[model samples]
Target: MTTLIETFAALSDPTRLDVIERLMAEGELPAGALVENTQMSAPAMSRHLKVLRHAGLVEQRVAGTSRLYSVRPEALKAIADWTMDHRTFWEAGMARLDAHLALEEGEGE
Candidate 1:
């Protein structure tokens, strides 16, 4: 439960989400690559990575002088699927709000 909260909280930040998205699509990346992709400083990127690490949203592997970060998709997918299952969640709310609802919503607006 705590891990789930931490994982969602970790991705709450835009920079961390950017890091996660880039790494997921591109595979493993070093700090420099993440920094370049995020346009954040080295220290800032490091801090974001730290938050992600603590949340179990990401894992790091050391390769020579650099550390590479990668997405743990199974854990992420578990969180996503769990959140998807809860009807009260914002994701579900949005999902429930599709085009059909929008037509009816126009009468109230």
Candidate 2:
């Protein structure tokens, strides 16, 4: 299982996040395909991919000479689980803020 820190760190980069979103939308794709339509060089993209791979956010498969990349479902699930676990904390904070704002408005009336 991938730690939340690693997963978040890898996704912190915009390029890396885009890569993950693209892979999720388009399914598995060759490294070459990932390089297309981007201003970044293949080497730079490769480095980003390496970070993602190390984070266990993506898996690489070798099809002969090509390297294909795909998002790992479990990695996403882990993130979702973490977020859900903290949902109540956020909801409570929001609720308190709303109540505070209501009190402030009433005070001004």
Report the number of the highest-lDDT candidate.
2
State candidate 2's TM-score.
0.87
Pairs of residues clashing in candidate 1: none
Tens digits of per-residue lDDT, candidate 2, 51-89, equal: 999999999999999999999999999988988999999
Which residue segments of model 2 deviate by more than 4 Å? 101-109
Q: What local lDDT does model 1 show for residue 105?
A: 88
Query: lDDT of each model, Cα atoms only?
Result: 0.84, 0.95
Please give, for residues 1-109, the per-residue lDDT of candidate 1 as tens digits.
3477788899899999988989889999998888886566899999999999888788999999899999887768878788678847775668778765887888785
Q: For each predicted model, how many residue pairs clash, with residues at least 3 apart or on different chains?
A: 0, 0
Off by over 4 Å in 1: 87-109
Pick out the ten consecutive residues of candidate 1 with the lowest summed lDDT: 91-100
Error of 1 at 72 (Å): 0.7
User: Lowest summed lDDT over 10 consecutive residues: which window, candidate 2?
Assistant: 1-10
